[model samples]
Target: MAALLLIATAALLAFRGAYADKVYPAVAVGDVPVGGLPRDAAETRLAERAAALAAQPLRFAAGDRTWTPTLADLGVSLDLEASLGAAYRVGREATAPDRLWSAANLVRNDRAVPFGLRLDLGVLGRWCDGIDAEFGREPRAAALVVEGATVSIEPEVDGIAVDREAVRAAAVAAVAAPSDGVAPLPIVTTPAAIRAADLAGARARVGAALAAPVAVVHEGRRWELAPEDLGRFVAPIVDPARTGADAVTLDLDQPALAAFLSERFAAEIEREPVDALLGWNEGPVVVEEGVDGRAIQAETFAREVTTAFFAPGGTVPVPVEIVKPAVDGTNLDQLGITTLLARGDSNYDGGSFDRDTNVEVGARLLNGTLVPPGGEFSFNGAIGEITADKGYVVSTVVQGERAGRDIGGGICQVSTTVFRAALLAGLPITEWWPHSYRILTYEHDGWGPGYDASILQPEGDPFGGGDLRFANPSDSWLLVESWTTGVHVVVNIYGPDLGYDAQFSETTFDGPFPHEEADLETVNPALPPGTIEQTEWPLDGSEASFTRDVYGPDGELLESRQFFTKFRGRGNVWQVSPDMVGQSPAGG
Candidate 1:
């Protein structure tokens, strides 16, 4: 008995030693057995099973069409190392008896080791793409067509879809079992949201309405919308009051109706104010009379048409408001247009070709302009943008004692003449600006020192103001006449003779400042040392002022305005000899 017990003990020890660090007997990976397998051997067996599973194919059917895809192409994979590790641990325990008992149970039944699984849905989706086109259809809903006063209902169709996820799930289960059979792609169906029965009442409401025509008439002009066009305007709808018993009826689309009226009548009824056309054939003549403006009253006309549209005749007369011209041909004589009311004249040295061009161009712009009663005139605006393209030229413009050349330099001559004309006409001088330096040309023609006016585009002027402007205080239109003869240019304002008088007091020059000299030396190598050359003459500086007074038609002083100005002496300019290098300027 002792010998037999030792042999049994040896056999058990051999068995444990042989199977060390390996899966015990009766252990299974899926349906395949891996009993007593080492880590490498178990992994090899699992890999073989994976290969065989990858070789299997699945039959996928959507209606009459069928597609087969291998399990490997569907992203099926197995972790052989993990499966082997689970099998190896089946009989592993801390105590010998517990390990022995676990080994006995493994030998008794084939234990399946649970494992994780993975699939690439992207690959599956690509295979299933477009499969639905053969087995799916979209549902169509009911619709209605509207004639002038009629509506009709259209039918609905059901929808069907080939289920995509269900097919993939079934494929997964088949691939996992390593077997192949026919699998169906589940199909789903649904009814459309709106059916033909829903529009029964709405259709009857539109079909039962009567056809009618409407007429739009204006000033002997008439346009009619017939029944055919009226048909396009009708539509059926759900019961608005929610009574659920009333049939939907045809109604006029008010927006569409209003659009039609605007299209046919808006342009025909709008007119702009026209001024009387004056002509001169030896004397002023009204060649073409001005017409009064007119505007269509859209709201009133629309209301009338809409009200009459439902009535018998359907005739509507257009409504418009008359707008009268401010100064019509009938009042040309009262505006003093037949006679001269005022005149302003000045002279310019036409010796400079470019300077004369600017002067003449600026004067022509002011000619023939008509200023209505209570209207203001802008000298700068009349000349527009002062560019070289406007026929002006680069010439001398003086700021204090500084002088520079500009394209529209001579425009100031025209502005100064206009300013004097405004003063003599007894009109309200709303705005005026004086030059930075007194221009001798302005004083040459019996005008005072403070009479010169200068101008530039708003951006170029430092004072941010216009050079000259005036308001026509007369109750009629005023016409400006301008012309140039030799070096003299004149501006005359013609309007109803207000019989008012204007006068300017003598210019007072009281304050005087002695002239100062400044040396503007230019190097002259040809001259001897200490030698000086005077290039410019200097003048004394002074302040001068004048007053303008205007009387009313009754000879009463209506308003008084004063003009004040100052002149700075142009400091003397001198050129020094280059030979005077070592000499003191004071010594000279």
Candidate 2:
């Protein structure tokens, strides 16, 4: 057993010696360990190789061109000093000794070397076509046939340094896995149609039918745009073909749309008023006459009113026409009459139409007819008479005291004044009457012609009351004016000039020829016999004639008109004392 043991030990020793010979030698002190040598020796060999490689040019072959780049040309090393700078530095300091084991691990760990990437869009140095190139191999054209992509690994010295390669492989597998590509979906707005839209029709149908509707909306303030009436607001809608997406965009002109909607869709409307004035019968005329010498103008009253149109926004007012009043002359017989007669019986009982009262009435008529075509004239309508009620003092009637007591007593004076005015106008007579018994107030003397008077009584015989009526008988109108100046009554007739030649000659017969007893008496008296108050005399008949000739524009006689009058005889009037005989007071 001992012998067998000795031989086996020897065999083991022999195998151990062989193994020790095969193992790498211990690195020198301060020298780094390399895979094949000590760190110091590995650095020396690497430096020699680098120096040789840098001196020569690097060769590169692409499709048809081969390029050699010297270290100087490639700008890799600008100088020998920069290339030789401590090429084997490991850690911080160049003088620090390299740890063999760590250096060996460090060299093995580093995988990437610095390289430049350049893209040549155009051929370098010469022009060429149909080619695009880069500093690295072409990505799309090169058939790599790679079992797997070559990848660099970053080793962790903190852990097992060699195991870091396996970790890098796993990370690369995660990034290289395939992923899906997605394109964004397009969105588009739809287009409007080219046909006319029913905008107005739709708006009208929205409200009540019987109501008055504002149909169209016109221009607006901000922008001058006409609103679409019924058929223009909406347009046809279309979809976008690319994305199968569709939408309608309202292309409303902002202001126009606002106006349209406000008018059409409105719930209520408004209204207003208007007024105007108008004229009648030509116009106001010039009235030269004034009341009591005060100048008065022609004036008339009128009326006016308003009209309106109500619109949606507000009221629009306008003007209308007016109506007026008119004054017309009717019952004109009084205007033309020239004479009147009133008589009292022997009783002195006031039986006749008082001459003064008749005269005043005639005055009123005269003034009215004198109003010119475009002039104004009035009587009470003109100058009003003052009598008992209107405050005129009473007086005995002129020409005849035999007439009974009357208020407007001596107003026959007014009648005479008007009669003269009428004559001056050359008016025509419609009626005329003479005073009874040839009163001296008119005839002045028994031989003088008597003044004509107008009687407005209904009707009477030739010997009774009669009326003289006359017309202006001219193209121009007349304005009659009369007023009492002190005791004289002045009358004026205003009219266009009438070219006339008028003349009158009167022939009177004798009067006071009747012989009668005294039949009338004083109120209180005791006079002796033969108290002759007056004498009654019958008058001789006589005739008087007037000739009126009108001339033309040349002053030649155009017409000769004649007027004739016959005087009748006066009857005998008696006077007597009241206490004497059968006659007490004649009127009583």
Candidate 3:
């Protein structure tokens, strides 16, 4: 009996020693037996199982639809080392007798070591979210529709929403035991917040607002907006403050209302302020009284109209802003334009019809010009642009050394007349330019050629033009008045006289340098063949100079200035047919 006991103890010792570094018999990891195997071997077996489970596809179902995704796609991974460690420690972690008893009992009852599975809840949740998106439906609220003058309502719709949490929980359970690989999507029905019955009050309000035509009144004039127009100006909007039947309200569209007002009433409500026209008749006189302008206040009108629109229709006054004129009747008397200072005249008789028309138009433009004390007056600024739109006609003008036809040809006659007036008035001349050649009209009435002033406005170059400018040196404002008789044009300056005598010396002439040739010709494609038109006659060049001396009321000399002019000789310029270009005329 003693010899048999020793042999059994040795066998038991060998069994305990073998399993001390390995898993006990009948122990398994997630239904895969790993007992009686070394730690490394157990790890390898569990790793292979993990890989197989990871590649296995799990099914997710919603109604008739199904999606198959692998465990790896759901971020599921098994901890092989932890599973091996848990299986190895199961029967060996207690007292010596208790450990021996547990290890022997494992042979009779098989033990399954729960898998050490790591599931990324975030990944599982997202996968379920994708399924939810495919199955979920959002509810639609009731809406109001408007067409022309009719109003209607659109009904609300109920929806279905998927329960994402239930899907995620099922996915986790399926991953733990990959044999159970199906997850079902859970869903609930939802109702819409706003029903068709809740919009009845709002619909009635909108209908009433569009039932009548509204009027906008200003200064005894009425502008009407019909029922169809009102429908376009008002819309139905949701208001959170009201409950049940008043969940929505009818409101006016501010931008639309303002646009309608501008399109209909802008011309009648807006006007430019008219400045008082000043003229010298005996003393100073107001040719026309100034009138204040009116402008519509768009924002103010919109606010007022909105209030009237909500009140279900009434007449609203149009808001207007008053604009005052620059020179009104109240300030005219303070200008102190009390006497006639000087007058200048020129003759336009025997001139072409276009020239005569231009002279008349130029005189009319400078009729009521008023220059403030010490203000610089520009001829180009006073007459504005010399365009056909301003009544100027095409006439003869000097271009380079020849004559041509262009707009504003006789405008220089007006400038020269005003120049002679400014010279007689003893005003300071800031800018003055002489003509390139002598003109017979400027030398009329015994006035010499050196006394003329010329102005040019080059096309497309506003700043490159020449202007005649002068400064008023008096203590009071100067009023320039002009008019044209059938034969002549006259310009007069009126202001408080400075009591000065302006004296000018006789113009001295030198050298009648004759022109080098008799005939200069150019091609004109527009002229008929064999036609010859003389644009300019030959003239001899000459130099002229004069002196101006201004004496004050006390006979003291105030200013002394000398003026000089040089004119280049020019031959007769002829515009002939293209065949005769570059050839002398018949007699030349």
Candidate 4:
């Protein structure tokens, strides 16, 4: 009987030795048998079981609705390594005796351990956030506004959403608990951004601003702004970033109100300023009298008017600026103009009426014109273009060897007269050019030979050609006066006494007109083909020169200069028509 008992004990001892290095028999991991296996083998089996369980979609049931979470949709993955380790720990760890007892009991009775699971918390949070995006709603704030005679209020709404952190923790906890791996989003209550009670005072302030009229008074004139018009002028300035009622304030829209005022009274209140005229008494060219002018100050008036429009019956003065003449008689005397510095005259007797007309027009243009000290004078610019509109008639003029007609045929009479006046005044001559051909009118006026300076339209003569120009060399203002009487065109220059004396040489005859005749155009239809008509009698060529010696008040010679001139006679131009003469062009 003792041997029989010993055999039973040996059998149990062999069993314990066989399974000591392995899991006992009849041990299952989540219904999968893994008995009598090593730790690595048990870990492998539980790992496969965990992966299979995780592979199946986790089904969650909440409020009569069921949802299955996909592995990717969950934004998380199960950690089989950690979960398999937990499953492997059951019945495998403890004191040596306890492990031995557990292993021995597993031989007689099967021990089953459920599969464990671990969720990545970071992934769980992201998954919760994604869920909220589709299912969450924010609360709406309340507002009250008064428009016209009616009142309106925007209603309030409650928010329905889940807390991301709470959902994340709950998900991880469910998976870690190693139960049915399911978690529901934890919903929290939310409040509105604003309340209707905060806007109670806004309605009162808006009503007060529109019930009254604004009065504006300027220079015995009173204007009242209507309530409807006033309402458009005042608005509530709101700050978008600020919440609650204090963010809005009732105030005047200054720019809009100012614009409205301008449209109402701009034409009625506006006055144009006129420049004062210089009244001359005698030929000495003295200053007369001047008057001050006034203009509206636009920006300043707008600002003042805007302030008045906001106040209760506020009075705003008319904003204005005292406009003064650019050249007034009071300041004109400061220019130090006192006496006539020089005079030049020319005769236009037995000439065309157009000749008289051009001289008169040019005189009017230059009569009241002023030349500042050291300023250059341009004859063409002073008289502008001598078009027919300016009362100039086409008259006889010279083109090459041909005598023709031009718009300003005799305007050179005025130019030559002013040239002599400028020369005698001892002013600097910047530009001057002689006519293409000798003209008799200059000699007829006692200006003699080289004293002539001629101008033609677009005169292409070399070196500032065709234009008579000069400068006021003195350090004071110089006034030009010109006029025409019967057959005489006169030019006079007045300024502060420059104390200049001028002299000129006697005309030296350069000989009779050059005996040269060329083909010419017959401008006068009366002069037919083969008709050689002599328009100007031959005038002998001559030379002349002048010396200007300007002196100071004490008779000191301030400057000295000699101007020399030479004249080329055109002999006489004979219009031999195109039908008679063989065209042989030539120039002198």
Per-residue accuracy of model 4 over 421-480 as CA lDDT, tens digit each? 887887777888766556666767466666667765654432343788888877777777
TM-score of 4: 0.44
- Report the number of the highest-TM-score candidate: 3
Supply the global lDDT for candidate 1. 0.68
115-211 per-residue lDDT for model 3 (tens digits): 8877787876676567657777787767677677777788988777656555555545665555544566466667666778998877787777667
List TM-score per model, in order: 0.43, 0.31, 0.53, 0.44
Comparing 1 with 2 on lDDT, the higher-scoring candidate is 1
What is the lDDT of every predicted structure here?
Answer: 0.68, 0.34, 0.78, 0.63
Identify the leading candidate in terms of lDDT. 3
- Sorted by TM-score, highest first, which candidate order results? 3, 4, 1, 2
Candidate 4 residue runs with Cα over 4 Å from true position: 1-280, 283-325, 398-402, 459-465, 513-517, 521-543, 554-559, 569-588
Q: What is the lDDT of residue 368 in candidate 2?
A: 33
Tens-place lDDT per residue, model 2, 289-324, is: 212111111011000000100122222111112222
